[model samples]
Target: EPEVTQTPSHQVTQMGQEVILRCVPISNHLYFYWYRQILGQKVEFLVSFYNNEISEKSEIFDDQFSVERPDGSNFTLKIRSTKLEDSAMYFCASTGLRGLRNSPLHFGNGTRLTVT
Candidate 1:
């Protein structure tokens, strides 16, 4: 079975620095998303992308954050300036079907970003 792959399983950065998290989803999947979980917080949806454009985004995805698919296979999330609040485990997910009830999302193990 195909799965999502994330690079640099762990990252440590100073506050106010920039960070880019990368992911490669299963080849056949259509919908892609980025989600995050702070150390003691719930998993929150950050943004969703489809057809090379942002489909939906949460309040957390503000001007400081951006996502792109530099290549058809890789998806990346870039934080222009990191804050202490930005420290969290970021997950990449993809689903072939549209609705949540129709298909379950396949998620990567996550890239843990630590801001100091």
Candidate 2:
């Protein structure tokens, strides 16, 4: 089965450095999303992309963050200036179908972002 794959399961960076987290979503999937989970918090939606544009984004997706489909399979999230609170688990998810209430998204193990 096709699956979402994320690189560098754990990343550590200084509080104000830049970091690019990468993911390879399922080949046939049409919708992609980024979510983050603070150590003991709920999974918060960051952004959703489809048809090469952002479909929806949350307040968490601020000026310092951006996403791109640099290639056919690679989806990337770049954080221009990381903050200490940015430390969390970033998850990449994809759905094969669009807007289907029953379409379950498959998620990667997530990249643990650590800021110091």
Candidate 3:
């Protein structure tokens, strides 16, 4: 199985600040996604990207969030003017073309964002 990796395992930012969370998904994966888990809350899906565009996004991925595939190896999630409620463990995940059943989502350890 391939691996997904995330950077800056932890981040601290004040409210209304911008922070870009970074990840490097498996090399050949065709789908990518971002999900988050607030303290004591269930993991929530944020966005999914494919073929260079956003394939789907949840309402929580409002104007405050953006995602990008700046290069072949990196996928990123950017939170703008983050609010205290944005504090969560942001995860980056990817899967192969066969879809979820054949290619179960591979997730990174996650970047813990603390918005104070």
Worst 10 residues of 2 by lDDT: 94-103
- Candidate 2 segments whose C-alpha is farther than 4 A from its true place: none
| CA displacement after TM-score superposition, residue 78 of candidate 2 (Å) | 0.7
Candidate 3: regions farther than 4 A off: none
Overall local distance difference test of candidate 3: 0.95
Q: Any residue pairs clashing in model 2, and if so which?
A: none
lDDT of 3 by residue, 10-115 (tens): 9999999999999999998889999999999999999999999999999999999999999999999999899999999999999975756577899999999999
Better structure of 1 and 2 per TM-score: 2
Task: Give the worst 10-residue stretch by lDDT in candidate 1.
Answer: 96-105
* Residue pairs in candidate 3 whose N, alpha carbon or C atoms collide under 3 angstroms: none
lDDT of 2 by residue, 18-91 (tens): 99999999998988999999999999999999888889999999999999998899899999999999999999
